[model samples]
Structure formats: C-alpha cells, structure tokens
Target chain A: AQSVAQPEDQVNVAEGNPLTVKCTYSVSGNPYLFWYVQYPNRGLQFLLKYITGDNLVKGSYGFEAEFNKSQTSFHLKKPSALVSDSALYFCAVSVREGGGNKLTFGTGTQLKVEL
Target chain B: DAGVTQSPTHLIKTRGQQVTLRCSPKSGHDTVSWYQQALGQGPQFIFQYYEEEERQRGNFPDRFSGHQFPNYSSELNVNALLLGDSALYLCASSLAGVVLGEQYFGPGTRLTVT
Candidate 1:
C-alpha cells in the first residue's frame, strides 16, 4: 500500500523567512513523490516531483523539496516566504496499476505567509 | 495549449440522484483520471481511463463509474449518490499512457449532495 502523511494541518511563516511543510510516505516499491499547491477554489497546481536520482527537486514559484530516503520524508521548502505563496499544499505518492497512475495524497497543510 | 477542462463547474443534487461529470484532457494527453476531494482532506483517486477503457481504479464502490471516448475525453457517473459524495470532483490528464509524468488538472467541479 502507498500512503502519504502531512503532519501539520497548518504552518505559519513570516515574509522573507524560510518556511517548511513536512511530508512522509510509505510505498511497497520505489516511490514517485510529488508536491502540489492549490489556491482558493482552484485546482491543484503541480509543484515538483521526485522520481529518482536527485534528492533535491526544484519547482515553480521558487519552491523546492528534499526527498530523504532514511527519514521517508519529502518536505517542501522555500528560502524566502511571500504572502502570495500562502495556499494549501499537498504531498502525493504515485502507484502504477493497469498502465495508469493513481496518486495517494496527504491531508495537506495550509501555509499562511504573513507580511 | 489548453489545460485539462471539466464541465459543469458546480452541481447540486439530492441523495439517490445520478450525476455525470465531463472532462477533456490537456492537449496531446490521452489519459484521464478522476479524483474526489472532500473538504479539508486530500483528493482520493476514483479511476483512470485510457484509449476508451478503464486502466485503473481506487477504493470507490461500484456506484462510481466512468467512460472514455476516442477523443480521450471522459465522463464520470455516480449512481444513487449519498451525502458523503459531496465534494470537489477533479479531472487530471497525463500523456504516454499515464506514466510517472506530471498530470495536469482542471479547475474541478463542485458536487453538493443534499
């Protein structure tokens, strides 16, 4: 079984400061992990994914995530926080079946970037 | 290129009623996947369609069904809907037979079951 967990329901960060949203996962096979962000009443926007090779994956909006094999964590991070970055972020794991991909997502963390 | 698109941005239905949601994949994408997202929770996989056939499914019951057209468009149908069915219905599209590539998503259709 493949599952994802985002421990924090909400994370608050001050502008210009670094921010982090934690995620963990469990998969029977090699994991295909992803990070997505959703604005108010909007669809999920792709951020970055960790398929293989690189432990650090860079994505849109100057955001990045680190895939830690030992810790089983993929935490989203940004060096400088911006109020516009405030949104709901989700971590997902992709499982292959029947020639298609099914994603199991974490409950998500709402990031609140304060000015 | 136009991203994935879903019809009927909002829907309201009563229990036991049937509902059908439509989706068109992103340009050049041939796989369409459906997901149900409850308020305050993550999106749950429903099923995926490719080449006019179902390729994968999640833990959803038989009441949830779907179809894919030759054009790669898809429709999600729910029979005898329950209050728990109220949520955002998201449609995602991917290329190359749903490989680990990025899947683009539509704005989603909000289904309100009363």
Candidate 2:
C-alpha cells in the first residue's frame, strides 16, 4: 500500500523566518507526490507535485518542495514565512495505474506562523 | 472556471440515516474522485469515477456508493451512517487522459453524523 508520513504534528515559525514541514512516503513504484494546504473550513488547495524530473518543485504561494528519492522524503520549504501562511498542510502520494490514480495522504501538520 | 463545486455545504444526519452529496467537476475534467476527511487527519480515498463507471475504490465498505452522470457530475451516497462517518467529504476531478496526476478539489460538504 502507498502511504505518506508527516512526522511533525505542528511546526511553529516566526514571521519572516524560514519554515519547513517534513514528509516521507512509501510506495511500490516511482510514485507521484503532492502537497496540499487546507484552511480552517476550506477544501484542500494544491501546492505542488513531483511527478518525474528535477528534485526541486516550486508551487503556489511561494512554496517549494524538495523531492529526495534516496531518502524517500519530500519536504515542503519556504525561505520566509508570513503570518497568513498559518494552515494545515498535508502530504499525499499517488501512483498512476490502469484504472485510476488514487491519492493516499498523511495525517497532516499544523503550521503556525507567529508574528 | 468555477473549479469544482459540491452541494449542501453542511449536513446533519442521525445514525443509520442515508446522505447524498453531489459534485460537479471542473470544466474539461472527466474523472471524479471522492475522499473522506476526518478532523485532524488527511483525506482518505473513497473511490474514483471515470467514463461514468467506478474505476477504483479504497478501503471503504459497501455502504458507501456513488454515481457519475454523463455530464461528468457525480454523487456520493452513504447508507447506514455511523458517528465515525462524521467528516468532510471532498470531491476532486481531473482530466482523464490529458492530465495524468493533477486533481482539482471542491469546497467539500461537511457531514455530521450524530
């Protein structure tokens, strides 16, 4: 089975400082990885995804994720944090199959950007 | 583009009651996927619909069923709801062949089973 793990339950970061949310995945094949953000009462919005090429994939809201194949980690990173960046982040993994592509996600990490 | 749209923003139901949620995929999208998101947890895949047929399903039980319309709209029907079934049901859609792994999500319906 394909699964994703976000080790941190919550991450606290000061405004204008660097922020990082770690994620690791387990899958049979070279899986497609995705990062999604959810606000208090909203649907998940896509951040970015790593399908095949270049290890570094940039996404919306000035966010980027580093896909490390050797470590099986795809950590979300941002150089500077904003107060509005506080939200719950989820890491999901999917493998393309003949029928459909199903996404299995991690428990999620609450990111708190303190002012 | 309206992105994806789901009906009944919030719903309340009792045990053993059945609830139906609707979703309209984004323009040009042909596949619809359903997910269950409990509080403080990531979304779990319930099933996927393609070509008006159920193409994939996750670990959910048979009590959860769905239907896809010719216009690419979808409906999720859950019978015999339990308190554990209280969750935010999400709907995602992606272009079948054009976009391999990209999925767009809808606002989701909040279902509370008492």
Candidate 3:
C-alpha cells in the first residue's frame, strides 16, 4: 500500500521568509509524489510532482519540493512566503508502476503565512 | 480550458434519501474520478470512469455507483444515504494513459446530511 504522511498539522511562517511543509511516504515500490494546495471553498491546485529526475522539482506559484528517496520524503518548499500563499497543503503518493492512477493522500497540513 | 466543473455547489439531504452529483471533465480530457472529502480530512477515492465504463473503484459499498457519458461527463449516485455521507464530494479529470497525469479538480459539491 502507498501512503503519505504529513507530520505537521499546521506550519506558520512570516511573509518573505522561507517556508517548508514536511511530507514523508511509505510504498512498496518506487514512489510518484505530488503536492497540492487548496484554498477555502476552492478545488485543489496542483503544485508539483516528482517522478524520476532532479531531486529538486519546481512547481507552480514559486513552490518547489525535494524528493529524497533515502529519507522517504518529499517536502514542499518556497524560497519566500506570501500571505496569499496560505492554504491547506496535501502530499500524495502513488506507486511508480501498476498503481492504476490511484493516489494515497496525506491528512493535509494547514500553512499560514503572516505578514 | 474551462477546467473541471461540478454541479449543485451545496446540497442538504435527510437520512435514507438519495442524491446524485454531476461532473464534467475538463476540455480534451477523457477520464474522470470521484472523491469524498470529510471536513478536515483528505479526500477518499470513490471510483474512476473512462469510456463510459467504470475502470476502477475504491473500497466504497454498493450504495455508491456512477456513470460516464460518451462526452466524458460523469455522474455519481449515492443510495440510502447515511449521516456519515455528509462531506464535500470532489471530481477530478485527467488525460487517460498520461502516466501519473495531474488531475484538475472542481470546486466540489458540499453535501450535508440532516
């Protein structure tokens, strides 16, 4: 079974400061990881994904994630946070092969960027 | 591209009633998946439909069923609704066989059971 874990229930960061939302996963095979953000009353927006390439994957809205296979982690990062960036973050994992497009998602982490 | 769209932004139903949610896949997409998200929790997969057939299903009971039209639009029907069925139902669409393609989500239909 593929599973994702987001250890933090919420992350607080000041605007213009760097922000990091932690995520880890457990899968029997290679992992396909993704990060999505959802604002209140809106649908989830895709941030980025890590299939197999550079460890650091850049995504929409100036966000990026590092895929650390050894640590079984794919933590989302932003060089500078913005108050508008505050939203609920979700980490999802799927098997690299034969998983049939099904994704196992984390419980989600609320990120609050303050001015 | 019009993105994914769902109908009935909000709904209220009583126990033992039935409800149906609708979704239209994004333009140029052929696959649609349904998910149920409880308040403060991650979305749980209900099923996926492609080419007017159910390709895969989650651990949901028989009460949950779906249908896909030739145009790639879809509908999710829940029978004998329970109070636990109250949640935001999400619909996502993606290009089939894209290999882990990113799914575009709709705003979701908020269903409240009374």
Candidate 4:
C-alpha cells in the first residue's frame, strides 16, 4: 500500500526565517507527490506537486519542495516564513502506474510561524 | 471563474439521521471527488465521479452513497449517520481522466452529529 509520513506533529519557526516540513513516502512505483495547506475551518489549498521532471518544484505562496527519489522524501520549504503562513500542512502520495488517482496522505504537520 | 462550491456550509443532525451535501465543480472540471476530514487529520477519499458515473470508490460502506448530475454537480448522501460521522466533508474537482492533475477544493461542509 502507498502511504505518506510526516514526521513532525508541529513545527515552530520565527517569522522571516527559513522553514522546513519533512515528508517521506513508500510506494511500489514512481510516486506523484503533493503538498496542501489548510486553514482553520477552510478546505485544503494545493501548494505544489512533483510528477516526472525537476526534483525541485515551486508552488504558490513562495513554497517549494525537493523530491529525493533515493530517500523517498519530498520536503516542503520556504525561504522566509510569514506569520500568515502558519497552517496545517499535509503531504500526499499517489502511485503513478495504477491510474487509480487515490491519494494517501499523512496525518498532518501544524506549522506555526510566530512574528 | 468561480472555484468549486459546496452547499449548506454547516449542518447539524442527530445519530441515525441522514444528510445530503452538495458540490459544484469548478468551471471546466468534469470529475468530482469526495473526502472526509476529521479534526486534525488529513482528508480521506470517499469516492470519485466522472461523466455522472462512479469511477472510483474508497473503503466506505454502502450507507455512504452519492450521485453526480449531468452538469458535473455532485451530492453525497450518508444514511444512518453516527457521531463519528461528524466532521468536515470536502469536495474536490479535477479534469476528467487526468491521472496526476491537481484537484481544486471547495470550502467544506461542517457536519455535526449529536
């Protein structure tokens, strides 16, 4: 079964500092990875995705993720974090072969960027 | 264009009661997917619909049913709801037959069962 793991339950960072949220996956075939952010009482917002090319993928709100095939990791990063960037982050993975389109997600990581 | 939209932003029901949540996919999107998001957890896939037919389904029971209209709108119906069913129900839409395309999500419906 394809699954994702977010090691941290919460990450605290001072505003204007760089931030990283770790994610790893286990899948049988090539993995399609995604990052999503959710605010309180709001639905998830797509942050970024890694499909075929480019190990480093950029996304909305100045977010980027590096896909490491050997380590099975796709960790989200930002150059400078803002207070508004604090939210619940989810890491998801899908198998590329089956065409099932089912996404297995991690529990989530709560990011708190304090000003 | 307007993004995906879900109706009845909030609902309250008692145990064993039924509930129906509606969703309208974003413009140009033909596939709709439903998810259940419990507090502090990631969203769980309930099912997916394309061309008004159920193309994929997760491990949900038969009590959780759905319908997709010709216009690409969808409805999720849950019968014999339990307290555990109280959570945020999210609806996402993507392009039809696209395997790895991004799915646009709507503001979810908050269902609370007492």
Candidate 5:
C-alpha cells in the first residue's frame, strides 16, 4: 500500500517570508511523490514531483521540494511567500512499479500567505 | 495543447438517481483516470481507462464504473447514487509508458447529490 501524510492542517506565513509544508509517505516499493495546489472551486494544479536522482526538485510558481529518503519526507518550500499563493496543498504518492500509477493523496494543508 | 477537459461543470441530482460525467484527455495522451474528491478531503482514485479497457481501479464499489473510447476520451457512470456521492469529479490524463510523465487534471465537475 502507498499512502501520503501532510502533518499540518494549515500553515500561515507572511508575504515575502519563507514557508514550508511538510509531507511524508509509505510505499511497498520505490515511491513517486508529487505536490499540487488547488484554489477554491477549481481543480488541483501540479506543483512538482520527485521521481528519482535529485533530492531537490523545482516546480511551477517558484515552488520547490526536497526528497529525504532517510526521513521518508518530501517538504514543499518557497523562498518567499506571496498572498496569491494561499491555497490548499496536497501531497500524493504512487509506487514506482505496478498499481498503474494510482495516486494516494494526503488530506491536504491549507496554505495561508498573508500580507 | 488543450489540457484535460471534463463536461457538466455542475450537476444536481437526487438520491437513487444515476449520473454520467464525460472527460477528454489532453492531446496525445492515451490514459484517463477518474477521481472523487469529497469536501475537505483529498481526491480518491475511482478508476483508470486505457486502450478502451479498465486498467486500474481504487476501492470504489461496482456502482462506480467507466469507459474509454478509441479517441482516449472517457466517461464515469454511477448507478443508484447516494447522498454521500456528492463530490468534485476530477479527470486526469497522462501518457502511457512514460515513467516521468505527470498527470494533467481538468477543472473538474461538481456533483451535488441531494
């Protein structure tokens, strides 16, 4: 079984300050991790993914995440926060092989970037 | 390229009624997956279609079903819907056989079961 966990239900950060949203996972085999952001009444927008090789991965909207194998973590981070960035963020995972890439997602964390 | 597209932006149905949602995959993509997202929760996989076949499925019951056309478009059908069936139906498309490929999602169809 593959599962993802976002420990925080919400994260509040001031504009122009750095921010982080934590995520962890468990999978029977190698894991493919992803981050997605969603606005109200809209579908999720892909942020970034960690397939392999690099521990640090950059994604759209100046977002990035680091994959930590030892800690089984993939935490989304931004150097500077923007009020526009406030939204619901989700962490998902799939097994490297088999399962047809069926993703298991976390409950999600509401990101609140205030000015 | 046009991203994934789903029809019926919003729908309202009563309990025990049936519903069908449509989806068109991103151009050049061959796989379509359906997900149901309940209020305040993450999206849960319903099933996936490839080559006009049901390739993968989640924990959903038999009442939840889908079909894929030769054009790679797909439809999700639910029978005897329950009030709990209300949710945001998301359609995602990705290229098959590409390990690094990421799924692209549509704006989603909101289903309100009363």
Candidate 6:
C-alpha cells in the first residue's frame, strides 16, 4: 500500500514571500513523487515530478520540490509567491509494482498568497 | 494539443439511477485512468484502462465500471448511485509504457446524486 500525507490544511503567505507546502509519503519500494495544483471547480494541473534524478526537481510556474529519501518527504517550494499562486496543492506518490500507474494523493493543502 | 477532455460537465441524477460519463484522452495517448474526488478531499483512483482492458483497480466497488475504446476514448459507468456517489469524476490520460508518467487530467464531470 502507498499513501501521501499533507500535514497542513492551509498555508498562508504574503505576496513576494517564499512559500512551502509540506508533503510526505510511505511506499514499499522506490517512490515516484509528484505535485499538482487545482483552482476552484477545476481539475488538477501537473506541477512537477521526481522520478529518479537530482533531488531538486524544477517544474512549471517557478515551482520546485525536493525529494528527501531519508525523511520520505517531497516539499513544494517557490522563491516568491503571487496572489494568483493561491490554490489547492496536492502531493501524490506512485510505484511500478502494479500494471497500472495510479497516484495516491494527499488530502490537499490550501495555499493563500495575499498581497 | 488538446488536453484530456470529459463530457457532461455537470449532472444531477437521482439515487438508484445509473449514469455514464465520457472522456476523450489527450491526442496520442493510449491509456485512460478514472478517479473520484469528493468535495474537500483528494482524488481516489477508481481504475485504469489500457488496450481496452482493465489494467488495475482501486478499492472502489464493482458498481464503478469503465470501458476504453479503440481510439483511446473511455467511459465510466456507475450503477445504484448513492449520496456518497456524488462527486467530481476525473479522467486522466498518459502514454502507455512510460514509467511513472505524469498524467494529464480533464476538467472533470461533476455528478450530483440527489
């Protein structure tokens, strides 16, 4: 079984400030991690993914996530936040054991980037 | 290229009724996966279709079924709908054989079981 945990229900940060949305996971084998963003009443948009590469994976919209194997964590970070960055963020994990690639996502963290 | 697309953006159905939602995978993609996302919750995997066969499934019941066509489009059918069945059904598409490929999701079909 695989699972993801998003510790905070909501994260508040001011515009132009750095922001971090925490995520952790548990899986039997090597973990393939990913980040996604969702606007109100919209579907999820892929942000970034950490398959097997540099611990620091850069992605769309100036967003990046660090895969920490020891800690079993992948935290999404951005240097400066904008009001438009406020949205629901989800962290997911997947492994190749099953024939299908199904992602297990976290409960989700609501990001509020205010000016 | 167009991304994954789903049909019947919003629907209202009575309990005990059956509903079928449709999806057209992103161009050049060969696999489709279905998920159920309840309000205030993350999406839950329902099943995955590849080569017109169910490759794998999650913890969902048999009431949740699906089919994949030759062109890679798919349909999700749910029977005996319950209040809990009311949720946003999401369809995602990705190329087959790509290890841990990032799936592109559709806007999702919002189903309300009255």
Can you tell me which runs of candidate 5 are displaced by over 4 Å?
A97-99
Chain B only: TM-score of model 4 = 0.97
- Going through the candidates in order, their DockQ values are 0.89, 0.80, 0.65, 0.69, 0.69, 0.90
Per-residue CA lDDT of model 1 for B1-114, tens digit only, reads 899899999999999999999999999999899999999999999998888988899999999999999999999999999999999999999996445998889999999999
Candidate 3 residues lying further than 4 Å off, grouped into runs, are A96-99
The residue pairs in collision within model 2 are: none
Q: What's the residue-level lDDT of A66 in candidate 6?
A: 96
Rank order by lDDT, top first?
Answer: 6, 2, 1, 5, 4, 3
**RMSD after Cα superposition, model 4:** 1.2
Best by DockQ: 6
> By DockQ thresholds, what CAPRI class is model 6?
high
Best by the lDDT measure: 6
Off by over 4 Å in 1: none
Candidate 3 chain B, poorest ten consecutive residues by summed lDDT: B95-104
What local distance difference test score does each model get? 0.94, 0.95, 0.92, 0.93, 0.93, 0.96
TM-score of each: 0.98, 0.98, 0.97, 0.97, 0.98, 0.99
**Which clashing pairs does model 4 show?**
none
i-RMS for every candidate (Å) is 0.7, 0.9, 1.7, 1.5, 1.5, 0.7
> What iRMS does model 3 reach?
1.7
Candidate 3 scores a chain A TM-score of: 0.96
Residue-level lDDT of model 2, residues B10-104, one tens digit each, is: 99999999999999999999999999999888999999999999999999999999999999999999999999999999999999886456789
- CA lDDT of B42 in candidate 3? 91
In order, what fnat does every candidate score? Answer: 0.88, 0.71, 0.57, 0.65, 0.59, 0.90
On residues B22-112, what C-alpha lDDT tens digit does candidate 5 reach at each position?
Answer: 9999999999999999999999999888899888899999999999998999999999999999999999999987884788899999999
- Candidate 4: stretches off by over 4 Å: A96-99
Over the stretch A1-115, how does candidate 2's per-residue lDDT look in tens digits? 8889999999999999999999999999987999999999999999999998999999999999999999999999999999999999999999977668989999999999998
Error of 3 at A7 (Å): 0.6
What is the Cα-based TM-score of model 3?
A: 0.97
